[model samples]
Structures are given as structure tokens and as C-alpha cells.
Target chain A: MSAKTWLPLLALAALTGCRQDMHDPPRYRAQGSSDFFSDGRVNRPVVEGTVARGQLRADTKFYQGREGGEFVKTLPVELTKDLVKRGQERYNIYCSPCHGMVGDGEGMVVQRGFRHPPSFHLERMRELPVGHYYDVITNGFGAMSSYASRIPVKDRWAIVAYVRALQLSQNATMQDVPEAERGKLSQEGRQ
Target chain B: MSQIFHPSANTIAKVSIFGAIFFAGGLLVILNEVNRSPYVTRVGVAREQPVPFSHKHHVGGIGIDCRYCHTAVETSSAAGIPPTETCMSCHSQIWADSPMLEPVRASFRTDRSIEWTRVHDLPGFVYFDHSIHLKKGVGCVTCHGRVDQMPLMYQQNTLNMEWCLDCHRAPEKYVRPREEVFRMDYRPQESQQVIGARLVKEYKIRKLTDCSVCHR
Candidate 1:
């Protein structure tokens, strides 16, 4: 009836026509299992109910560590090492811009304009366990978004484990290292 | 007091009391029926759907994943109801002849979403994140019951506090491999409790017994 309304309806009709055109061609797919599964192909999207093939999690005895042993432990997840490495790389990509290269909260973004996050080593977090660290990374403790979608579960754990490594390295003392290693370092530096 | 034979008066009094008791019993039964799941009853009264889209048929018989039809469990904030296109994916081949499926075809042409009544629901504030639960290895059956076996999927489990606490207190009882976690009727395929127990200890789980663990 109105000129404003007619223009919008005309535009909407064009948009629907465009969508109908797009659907006319099978441009996208659900990425179901293809040759990539058995042929050592990469990036297979595991849909629901598609018996997880070669899932690293399969046969992983429920334990804290990676093995099925007498003693119980936290998940030494199948991706424990791989995830940690990926996390470090991803952290460098997505987080290092703000949380610093080492998660000390002195990232380039913070230096430039963004608010600094607490160093993962700070008292508030030094006492925090891996779950707390993971929660923060996933949900963003403060001024952060949920990386729940961005980071997969296994990778988040890896980042948490890596953060622990960073903390350990920063707080290391001479006694903490092997005496033989310290001797080599001292000698190498002196000579 | 019995100067005259009061047998007729006595009979009338007995009939009056008996009639009153019968009326009360009938009223009680009617009230009980009205009290049971007031929501579904109102739905039965109004909004006549063109086809009886039984969740029981899809979930119970064919063992279709809710996400298969809902389709938004992972990426979106809302797990969207199935569009006619999603239904036509199967119905176009399977139920092409059924008059019941006529509504589905009509819906596709009309571009309308099927208004399937949500049977099991929670308060909006409760904020149940299906994705988070999925990530934690909480199986669909933990809340939904054995949906794949239903002919007409009905709400089997009451989403009450105690029901949730029973699972949360013993997450190992419910937690399964992430792959099978979406299964609507998956019991632990193996003994994960021993490993689950160790994880509980190793992780230094502080709040198994705490209310906030599940309530929050």
C-alpha cells in the first residue's frame, strides 16, 4: 500500500528468489563419511550416531591418565600432547594478541589498548586447578567470549596443561633442575 | 424419640448421605484427571495439528537422533524445530503415499515450520545448554529416556530436581564416551566407574555433594 512497504516487499521477493536459486544447485554438503575415513584422509566431520571410527577416545580406558591401570587418575586424554601443542599454537594466534605469548597478561593487545588479564601465574590462578583454567579459557573469565565454539574440548585441556608448564618454568629454581643439566648450562655459559 | 415408626425417614436419610458420598467421589476423580499434565490437556483441547507428528515413531522405532531432525544442537543457541524440508528428506522416499504425510508436503510448499508441541520443557531461567551437556558426555537418555523405542514419544522422565541430582551426584553413572553420548538410551557400555572414581579423586572434585554443583 505504502511506497516504503512496496520497496521492502520487492527487495524481500528478490532475496527469496536468490535463495531459491542457491538451493537449485547442490552447492553444499553435510560432509558425511567419504574415502577420507579409511584412506587416511583428513578433516572428517563426525556426525552424530556415525560410530566414531578410529576415534582416539575409543578403547581409552576411563582414567585420569592415558592408560587403563590399577590406579585412577585424571584424563591423560588421547590428545593430551597433541592438543597441548595445538593449544600453544592457537594461543599464539587467537590469545597471544591479548593474553601475551606466555599468558602473563602482557599481550600486544593489552599494551596497545585492551585491558590486561591477570597472569595465569598470579595468586588468584596459581591456586586454580586445570578445570578452573579450562573454564576460564572456554567461557572467558572476564572481558572474554566463550571459546566454547572456537576451541574444541581436547585442545582446551591441552592449553590448560601448557599453562601449567609455563607456570612451572617461570617458578623453577636451581634445585628444581637436574644437577647434571645445571652443570652443563653453567659450564657452557662460562666457556 | 421413636414414638412413631421412623423407618421411612431413616431410609430417606441413608439415601441422602449415600448420594452425597457418591457425588464427592465423582468430583474427586474428575479433579484428578484435570490435574494431570494441564498443558497437554489444553493442547488436546485446542490447536488441532494436521498430522500427528509422533516423536515416538521417529525416535523410538527408526532410532533417529533428535539432532538429526532438530539440526541445531551444536551450532545454534536454539535447537530448531524440523522444517518441512528436513521432513521431506525422509518422507519424500519413505511415506510418499501416506495421506498422513500430505500435511508435510503441504507445509513444504507453504514454507511453514511444523508446530510440534514441546512436551518436556524447563523454565527459561534454568538455561539448559544442550551443547555443554553434550561436551560433558551427558547422554540424551539421561534426560529424555529410551526415546528410540517409543511408538509415540512421551515424556518419560520428570525433569525434577531430584531426578537431576541422582545423575549429577554420580556423573559416572550417566557419562559415556562422547560419541555415544547423544544416544537416547545408552547405558554405560562398560565399567567406567572405576576410572570415573579415579578421575573424581585425581581431579580433586570439590562439590559432588554440594547443591550448587547441579543447581547452578
Candidate 2:
């Protein structure tokens, strides 16, 4: 063939040769659909009456937030400063959208028109047991939806601890402050 | 023979020989550019999704944290896409009557996937872990490019291997404090080199450039 005829054809072939066969090999990725499965999902739901490794739920107080058909009054895990701090971070992410930073039910979501969750400082809310908060977080209450899928067992307890801290902070008095911390508070107040 | 080559034919032959070199060079340059352009990479191009979910409205306007919906970002290889229930958690009441959210509601009621178009799909050969990157003090804005500013999700960067190497080769150029990893509006107080170098040491971030590190 003449050079005039072949040169443009060569350039066109080179440009169009970028087939993405290697870029997307026939395989399932996370959350991808599959025709091999009847459900059209790559993930198969766990079969009934079978528990996966390390997934036994023997502790009702920890997992169910209840003991002997009643809500437990205390946390199943140890309360520590680190746990509360972790809860603070998780709370600001998960719950604070609808529950407010201080748990006053005035969160941005509520401001944008979601139903108002009651204030944590209310007498009825303050009187509720610690497990009640955990239950609500796990199973949800009223306008709230279950956060079980989003929050794990331990993180739910941590958020419960932080909610208690927020409740206490709202009603704390001068005498509630430690003797050493009292001077610091007064100094900061003066400044 | 009556002169097979005319006198003007010599001039044509010389010009064509010189033109071929320039043509070949220009073709190579154009091919290289086409490989990187948005037409090929889909970078900065927002695709049509089943629902027009706005990251700007949720993240920038409402101030919801990234982890609010993407709960597994810090712990899993895949940053989990929130299930339909996560949308209805607020939308059940927030915009319950809006026609725009009918797809979300239908997905929830029918137990079907929303089938959102994947914006940042990497080739199967390249392995990426969101947890590891966030653990090493890489901010969400580093790869996602200020998601709060995006009205609809788009691939923010070219996501080419060369772009990956740009950071892997010198992580001290982008590493921030671990606490600031989730902050969308995070700006370094001092120079990035100063902050990144200190955090790189503090976080024990290694400059991983091995082929197996990503390819495996």
C-alpha cells in the first residue's frame, strides 16, 4: 500500500488499541453483583443455625443490654477515660447528627427537620438505667433507627458512657469538682 | 525513458521526508495526553447515579462526619457504603415526603441495593486498604479532594500509578496528625513538610514502594 494510505491507518490503530480488558477482568469486587449467585449478589447470606468464628453471643448483658428480662443498671465493660474519649469521637460522628453535641436533642439533623429526641438532662431520661441507653443504641427507640449495623458492641457501650458523662456535666455543682481541680476552675473563671 | 521523475517531484520528496518525522513525534505526544485525559481516566467527571446524593449538602452544610455513613473507613479495607437503612435513619423523617428520596425509600422497603455508580474504581490488580491509609495519617482530603465541596461524587484525582507513587515516594509531603485524618477542612498550622515529617516519625509511617505492597 502507498505511504499516504498506511500512515493515518497506523495512527488510528494505535489510538483505538486501548481496550480495557485487563482493567476490569471478570471477577467480583466488594459489593459487586454476580450472575453465578441466584440472588445476584456476590455475598451469600450466612446459613441458618450456623455461627461463624468468634461470633457467639453468650453474654446477654453485653450484647442484649439486659439481664433476666430487665435492663442492667451498669455497664458490662470497665469505664475508663480512654473509653469515654473514644466514645466522644464516635458520638460526634454517629449520634451527634441527631442527638446534638450536648445531647439536648437540638442536633443539626433535628434543626434540618428530623424529630427531636428528648434532652438527656430531662428527669425521666436521667432516671433511665445505663442499659436502657445501650438498648436504645442497639435496637433504637421512637424516631431513631437501629444503629447495630453501624456501631459494634463495645463502641455502643462507650457511647453510653459518654452520654452519662454529658448528663452529669449538665447538673454538676461547685462541690462536685475535685479539690485540686476547683482552684483551676476558679482561676480560669477569673481570667 | 521520458524522465519518470519530474523536476518538481524532487521538492515534493524532500518535504514529505521531513514532514514524516514531525508527524510521528506529534502522534506520540497526542497518544500520551489521551491516556491521561478525563476521556480515559474519568477524573473530575460526575456520573449519573440512581439518586443525586449531594455530599456538599450532607458534609459541608449539615456538618456530618465522614464516618457517620462510611463507618468502616478506619477499620476495613473497603470503606463501607452505608446500607439503605442508614439513609432512612434520617430521611425517614427529614425528607419523608420528598419525591427525590423515593429511590432510597423503595430500596429500604424492598430490600434491594441502591446500585450507586462506583466513582473511584481501581483495577483488580491494584490492592488498596482505606484503613491502612487512614492509620498512616493520610487525610480523606488527600485522595478524595475535599469531598465536602463536591455536589455529586466524582473521581477527584487521576488515580494513576504515577499519582500513587508521588506520595509513596515522599510521604513526608502529605502525612498529617492521626487525629486530623477525618477532618475535611484540615489545614496544616505550620508548613506541611514540617508537620508531615514530625507525624511520619510519630506514626512510624514507612515509605512503601514495593511492587508486592500494592500489586499483591
Candidate 3:
């Protein structure tokens, strides 16, 4: 072939060489081997007393939901309307799938044949301290996994407060509603 | 003196000219085909998996929420694959003897995870978080197309960097209400731009153009 005819083919060959297919870079995969470390593991163990940034977790009552080996009776955070609202939203997204919107433990997951969790309306559940809920969420119970990774610390407290509200809701009597609100209930009754 | 016969150069020139044109046109056609080929984009190609899990039957027919299987989408970076227990929760009682679900049963018994083939894989350089996207009001249908219609899951978008930047540059065009994020069939009641602009302010969304935002 003439030089001119071969020029185009040469260009195509050169272009093909420039492909970006080098995906596996020199990096360690999870639990990969390492030559630099004496232990031969890619991940190094945390140094003694080395706390990750923003993970000091000094407040035992707030982090661990306990004081002197007993669950705290009161919520660690300040209760507010917004906090409960946030809790309601978070609860529907996370807890409601298995615990039901009313905390009756008849969630969609259970309807699909998963183990049924006890209803919050039970006397045993209602009598349990707020910290007990926090502990269960922080470190799972029965077949349920720990939600600590999924729910942040403050959100966990918020969910605990919402669960308490749910317990009160199922057990509430006519006296629980104010006299003014009672009229609204009777108005709906007429309809 | 002898009259020398000259070869016809005209025919050679015409042939070379036509050949070059034909080669260029053929090259263009081939390149275009390669660009849209299934091998490159994988759009509409249903990949084989260990289990033939049908999103159509599960999501559309059975009316299961996306979060039921992808439990960690709201909080974690990854939309986690459901564990064997999630399948056995239903299959154990319903399709207990079905040969198709034997893999699920085996996985549950062995406590081994099913090696599901990833469909919408992004390059290692790009970091995409499901939580931030869902929290920002991007619907499941926005990038995934109509997944409820797919019997077997397949990638619906090119998922190229250019495709990603098209939305990130102007998120208001695609953003929906937080409640509507999981609604697979959700359509904007008003113009998307008007709703998106309001949500942009409400959600405090800023236009992120920095390479480090995703590249890092």
C-alpha cells in the first residue's frame, strides 16, 4: 500500500492504544493483604485509646442509655414539637416497616411472614422505661438487628419519644382529650 | 522519435477519491453503531442474576415499597441488597417447593449471600450516594426509568458523567417532594421548574459544580 493509504490505518491503531481501561488501581480492598504492616493485614488496628473524630461518646446516659447500670427514666434530649415531628417522619421511614405506624408490631414486614414483634400496647412494653427502647434500638433485640448504624444518636432518642407517645395514644380515654377537642370528636360522630 | 503511451491517471484518481469518501462514510456509520451498541451502554439489556427476581411482580403487582428490600437507602450511601432472610420471609411459606426459588432456600440454609450481578454500576472514581439523592427529592424513576415495568432489572440510563452533570447543574428541574421520591409513577402536578425552584429553596440545595464533590 502507498504511504498515504497506510496513514489512516496507523492513526486508528494509535487511537485504539489510548483506551482508558485501567480500572484496578493500586489500592487495598477490604481485608486485603499488606506487605508494609507486620500483621500482614491491610487494615491497621486502632491505637490504644484512639477515638475517631467526633466519636468520643463520653456521656454514658446519652450514648449508652444508662446510668450506674440502670436505664434512665427520662429522655436525654430536650423534648419539643419539632423533635417529635422529626421522630414521626423518621419512625415511618425506618421503624414503621416492621413495628407498624401505631407500634402494634403488625408492620408490612411481619405481614410477609417475618417474626412478629410484641405490640407496644402490652403492659410489659408500656411499663418499660424510655431508656429500654433506646437500648433495644442501639443494640437490637431478638431477630431485629441493631439500628444504631442506621439511626443517629439524637434520632434514636426522638424515636423513643415517639414510641412513648404511641403507647399513650392506644391507651388514651375520653378524659385524655380536652373538653374543646371532645366537641370535634362528637362532630365527626354526627357525620 | 517514438510516441510513448501514457497510462490513464484519471481513472486512478477517481477511484482513490471515491474509495476515501466511502471509507470515511463507513467509518462514521461504524462509530455511531458502537456508540449505541448494547456492549457499551448496556441499556435495555437484562443481565442474568443468581435469582431471577422480577421487579414487576414484586413492586407493581405485589405493591412492595422500594425500601422493603433496599432497607438502607435513606441512611446509608448504598441502597443495600436484601439479605437471604428477606426472601425466605416470603418464599419459605409461599414458594417453599418451587424449583425456581431453590437458590434462595439454599442461601438461607447455608447462610451464604446470593451473588447478584450489579446492573447500575458506576466507575470507581465517582461517588454516588443514594441517601442524599433520595433526601433531595430525586425520585426513583428519575434515573432508573420505569423499573416497575421491567420484569428483570436492567440499566436504563448511560450513567455517564455528562448524564449526571445534566441534573446536578440544575437539580430544580428533576427535584420532587420528599414524599414523592419513592412514588415510581409520580408526575409533577405543576411545571417541574416551578416546583423544583421552591423545593431548592426549601431544601437549601446549592448547585454543586466542584469536581471534588463526587470525584473525592
Candidate 4:
């Protein structure tokens, strides 16, 4: 075919090819339940009682009337047999190997070759609010890695409660022992 | 005939005219969309598993947390599968009498990691952190899809780089409470626009409209 005869064909091809743009805008779909508005003015419902995760730092206070970077939710946990049992189970699973069953940092890993994890009964840790331990577990202390993912949030709190109980175990003296338990303790060999 | 061809002005004009037309046409095509064939990387569906494991069952059913199975996701670089030891913890007593437990037991002996076929894979060039996502309130279902309903878990989302950038472009719109961590259908209770505005001011979020926010 002569070159002149192909001009219309090339022009037609160019027109078709030019319209073949692959970047068409997506269809705007309607949102239900929670709406995503495009305009700057819109309302959002922030969860009333939840804290933002991955954002809470040691320097920020999460408790009432505290305006510092430190977390302030520190209160002795209420004693419950089930809570203690749960605490013990979690402790055995994650902590016993390094801190021992009794919180002395003498578990199997330490016995074999791991470095010593500090005893929970140390005065500095003992006096620290439960949140202190929580932070350490979530963020990790010296030579330790964060356990936030290994243990669930509630379980870590439970483990902290269990650690307090272990700390008290070393502090218990004659007056602290209950009469019923003391009788059983004092009569250990007689029976 | 040779002398006649040399003196023909019509022949010279015709050839020049065609040449000019072809050159302009080529230029116009190039100026438009005259690109070479694109390079697309496509590895099709991987081999199916012997026994389908459901993200629906463990994560959706029985309320077993993601940490129960993929335990290392939070602290370690890898989000790993539970060892046979983790499985045996409950299976030792719970499923000892079941016939299906045999494959699990066999897997333990072989030291295989269940081969749990990966469905949601991202390109190697991209870096994602499960801990950060989980902590920041991106649910498992956000990208994994309705895992609770599936028996055997497969990749739920395409997980292409564009797919990731879609959310990164406007995170507040996609982000929700940590409680909704895996539910893809979850929407922020308030309007995304309002939340985004509040988030910018409250959290001091520096950049949202920036391309580098998602891309390297």
C-alpha cells in the first residue's frame, strides 16, 4: 500500500489509543455504620475510656489529676483466688524460666546460662507503682525485650499482680501469717 | 526510463510527503501513550494446604487472641506460628482422642511449621510492622478480610503496594479502636474527616498529604 493511504488509519489508531487511559477515578461508594466525610468539618466519636496503643509513653500520665509523662494507675490489686491462679499460670509460662517460680530470678534459663533478671522484691521495684512494672514489661528494661506481644494486656497485668504476691512472700513474718495457716505450718512434722 | 525518473518532481514530492506524515505520526504516538509493554510480577495462587486452617476459627471463634498463635509479632521482627509445643499445650488433653490430631502430631515429629500457606504477602521492597499496626488499631480483618468465617485461611487482601498506600494516604479514615484490630469491616465511629482533624491536632500528626508518608 502507498504511504499516503495509511494517514487516516494512523490518525484513527492514535485517537483510540489516546483514550485508553488506565487511571480512571474510582466510583464513590456510600459508607454505612461509620461515615468517612471528605469535607474538613465532621464529627467523630472517640472511645470514652480507652487509651491509644503504641502511643502511651513512660512520660505520659494515664491516671486522674496527673499531668506528667509517667503513668499513674497504681493500686494494689484486689486479692482473688482465680486472679492469683491466672497470675501463677501466666508467670509459669513466661516468667518462671527467668525469674523463677518464686520471683527470685532463678528459673531454668538462669540455672542453665541466662543472665539474672532482678528480683521483684527489690525496694526500688517494690515501691514502684504496678504501672512501673507494666511499662517495663511492655517496653522492656535493660537487657530485656518487650513482652507486650508475647503476653496479652490483661495477662501482663495479671503477671504484675502475681509478682506483688511473690514479693510479699519474702516479706511475710510471724505476725503476717494467718492463725489457721500458721497452725498448719507449725504442725508440719507432728502429724 | 532512467532519465525520465530523475527529472520527475511529482515522485520527489510524493516520497517527501509520506516521510513527513510518518514522522509526525510517530511523534504523536510517543507523546501520548506509546509505552513499552509493562513489567508485571505475578506469582499465581500457591499450593493449597492438606487440612484447611481457618483464621475464622481461632481468631474469630473461641476468642483466641492473635498472640496465642503468632506469638512473636509484637516484640520480634517475625510474626511466627505457634510451635507444636504451643499446640500440644491444649491438644495434648483436648484432642488426644480425635482422629484429626494425628496430622498435627505427625507435623510435630517432622519439625515442620505447618506450611500454613501465606495469602497476604507484601512486596519485599515494603516494610510493615505487625506490632505497630496492631498497637495503632489496625484490625486483623482490616487487611486479612473476614477471617472468622473462613475454614482454611488464605490471603484475604491483595496486599499490593497500592493497596497499602490507599490507607496510608488517609490513615485516620482507616484507623479505629484497637478492639477492632482484625475486623476489616470496622469503621471509625466518628466521621473520618473530623477524627483526622482531631488526630492532627491532638496527636500532633505531622504529615498526611505527603507521599513519603507511605512510600520510601
Which model scores highest in DockQ? Answer: 2
Shift of residue A109 alpha carbon in model 3, Å:
2.6
Better model by lDDT: candidate 1 vs candidate 4: 4
Q: Of the candidates numbered 2 and 4, which has the greater lDDT value?
A: 2
Per-residue lDDT tens digits for candidate 3, residues B87-178, read: 75456566678898889988888755666787887776777899999988889899998889999999999897878999989999999999
Model 3, A1-191: lDDT tens digits are 99999999999999987765544356764344568876565646689999998999989899989999899999999999888887887788678867898999997767866678999999999999989999999888887767775678999999999998899899999899999899999899799
Candidate 2 chain B, run of 10 with poorest lDDT: B108-117
Output DockQ, candidate 1: 0.02
- Candidate 1 A-chain TM-score: 0.57
Query: Best-fitting candidate, measured by lDDT?
Result: 2
Candidate 4 residue A13 Cα shift, in angstroms, is 27
Error of 2 at B193 (Å): 1.3
User: What TM-score fits each model?
Assistant: 0.39, 0.94, 0.74, 0.44
- Among incorrect, acceptable, medium and high, the docking class of model 2 is medium
- Pitting candidate 2 against candidate 3, the one with the higher TM-score is 2
Span of ten consecutive residues with least summed lDDT in model 4 chain B: B36-45
DockQ of 4: 0.03
Q: For all candidates, state DockQ relative to the true structure.
A: 0.02, 0.70, 0.18, 0.03
Ranking by lDDT: 2, 3, 4, 1
Candidate 2 lands at a TM-score of: 0.94
- Deviating ranges (above 4 Å) for candidate 4: A1-157, A160-191, B1-47, B97-99, B182-187, B200-216
Interface RMSD of 1: 22.5
In order, the candidates keep a fraction of the true contacts of 0.00, 0.70, 0.07, 0.03
Best TM-score among the predictions, by candidate number: 2
